[model samples]
Target: MYRLVLLVLLALPLAGCFAPRAEDTARNWRPMGANGLALGRLVALSPGVTRATWEAFAGIKGQTVVRLAAEYDPVRAAAGCPPPEAGMVRAARSFLIVDLAVTPQKSVDFIAAKAQAYSADGYFEEYDLDIGVIAALAARARPMPCADLALPGYLR
Candidate 1:
């Protein structure tokens, strides 16, 4: 029984290696809860402050990290994501939706901690996401003007 449990534990990472790729469009991506992806491996598909932060945090000394980013689009959220948190709707339109994503290296605890930090900063709401979904969102995301909503050194 101990051996079986050990085997299962060892195979967990390999399981992630086989998960389906998230389609490259918000319209094609599954809804948040329905996205059949583990909470680990958050997505960041474009270069920006958030992406840089995530890379510094999770990219271990020799690990090949894939960094990405997506600008938040309220118009696509209704179709691609779950309903926004209470203040998110107004904030999304007014403030830059600076959601952050980490690749599949850090533990869930690490992400939870990062989320707490991001939330306490009072900038944008954080969401658990897979790299594929983020890629899809990135593909569909248009360059919306965020100069008025952006905070210095935050997502851009």
Candidate 2:
């Protein structure tokens, strides 16, 4: 009887260990480490891949869902850390593109806030890097607050 009682106590703790923890719904960004940049590099390396094949290769059924967000390298820089290397910047940029593709509104909102904080320079840099973002905004009839200035012909 004592053995069974101890066994039951041990199993009870095991059961508690397997219990699900609460999900953090408020946090939208997820870190994917090096794995996060793989898809972007693949796309960059290979062009004209058929949608079906790409979809099959990147099927979500067995894959983990990762939502990329802006990197906090600035905070690290403030702490005396060196600026991110080219690969890290590429990963961050790729992640931002994925975020823009998957969640346009959220991405735009984030970009807009950044633009507001940093002024037209932020928008100009973002626009220069990715025209797709501006196109996405236009397609959705969303206002581009950062386009407040009369950009030169070169920028247009």
Predictions in order: lDDT: 0.33, 0.27
Mind giving the per-residue lDDT tens digits that candidate 1 earns over 122-154? 665443433343333344432222222223343
Highest TM-score: give the candidate number: 1
Off by over 4 Å in 1: 1-58, 79-122, 131-156
List of clashing residue pairs for candidate 2: none
Candidate 2 residue lDDT tens string, 62-143: 3222232322222221233344333322111111222222221122112222211122233233332234433433233221
TM agreement with the true structure for every prediction: 0.26, 0.17
